[model samples]
Target chain A: TQLLEQSPQFLSIQEGENLTVYCNSSSVFSSLQWYRQEPGEGPVLLVTVVTGGEVKKLKRLTFQFGDARKDSSLHITAAQPGDTGLYLCALGGNEKLTFGTGTRLTIIP
Target chain B: DVKVTQSSRYLVKRTGEKVFLECVQDMDHENMFWYRQDPGLGLRLIYFSYDVKMKEKGDIPEGYSVSREKKERFSLILESASTNQTSMYLCASWGQNNYGYTFGSGTRLTVV
Candidate 1:
């Protein structure tokens, strides 16, 4: 089975600061997705990157799939308190999606 | 916007009691899933359905069962609830080719 590893299991930063979190795996992937989950809610999809070296931006957040397809990163510019949540990266499989352990982010205002 | 709705936002049940958690999706998705969320474990899949009356086991399906009687509703059943089974349950529906799944808010179930 393949496993996904995310760096800095927990993160805290002052509002307006920039932050970046990473997701990695030893196995190559065809696609990867990022999601954000808040308290008392299920995870919501943020972005999906299919091509190696591809990058997609949503407002102040930027997501990139590694050139080797073994890693990905999410960068948040001018982070706000609303940006705080658990971030997860998932890989789709035969009939299900495998998820990473997740990175909990806290943006202090 | 597409929506996946879970029956309850919170629930409390006694150990050994049979519990049923319902999930419905409005997007007419063919795939529906049940997952349990924990503090460190992230979201662990419990069960899923490909279509009505079609069910399959997931990563963790020991004490749980699922039902997909209709095309839009999928229900997760706990044959015998236990303290260890207490967790936030999430329901999701997916469209083919698009990996961005639509998920319900989640039902927080506590077994005492």
Candidate 2:
């Protein structure tokens, strides 16, 4: 079974601070996706990175795929109270998508 | 816009009772998935269907079953609901594109 592990399971930072979350796995993935989920609701897709060393920026959030395709990272700049939520990394291939243990972010105002 | 609809928003059932969670997609997606989300476990795949009447067990499928009678609909069944089975059930669908998945609002189930 393939497993993805995320670091710093819980994060609490003040508004306007910056933070980064990492997702690591031993198995290489063909593509990786990032999602943000609010409480009591389903997750919404933020971005998808396919190539190694590829980086995609969505407004204040930047997502990068590892050079080996075995890891990924999500970096948020100038975080605000609205950024408080759970971040998830998913690897997709062969008609199946495996999700990593999420990173919960709390932004203090 | 693509839409994946889950039948229930919140459900409470007694232990040992049978439960059914229904999901439908308006985009006529060929692939549908069922996942359960816990506090630290993230979203664990329970079952997925690629076509009508065809199903595959996901990472965690011991106590769960699924049925896809039509192309746009997928149903997840819990033979016997238990306390451990209580979680937020999510439904997702994907088309030919590999961009991302479309998820439903989610159904929160509580087993008493």
Best by DockQ: 2
Clashing residue pairs, backbone N/CA/C < 3 A, model 1: none
**Per-residue alpha-carbon lDDT of candidate 2 for residues A5-94, written as tens digits (9 for 90 to 100):** 998899999999999999998798889999999998889999988999999999999999999999999999999999999999999774
**lDDT of model 2 at residue A43?**
90
**What is the number of residue pairs that collide in model 1?**
0
Worst 10 residues of 1 chain B by lDDT: B93-102
Cand. 1 Cα-lDDT: 0.93
Q: Which lDDT value does model 2 have at B106?
A: 99
List per-model TM-scores for chain B.
0.97, 0.97
Q: Over the stretch B1-112, how does candidate 1's per-residue lDDT look in tens digits?
A: 7799999999999999999999999888889999998888888889999889999999999999999989999999999999999999999999776577889999999999
lDDT of each prediction vs. the true structure? 0.93, 0.92
lDDT tens digits by residue: candidate 2, B3-96: 9999999999999999999999999788999999988788999999888999999989999999999999999999999999989999999888
Task: Give per-model TM-scores.
Answer: 0.97, 0.97
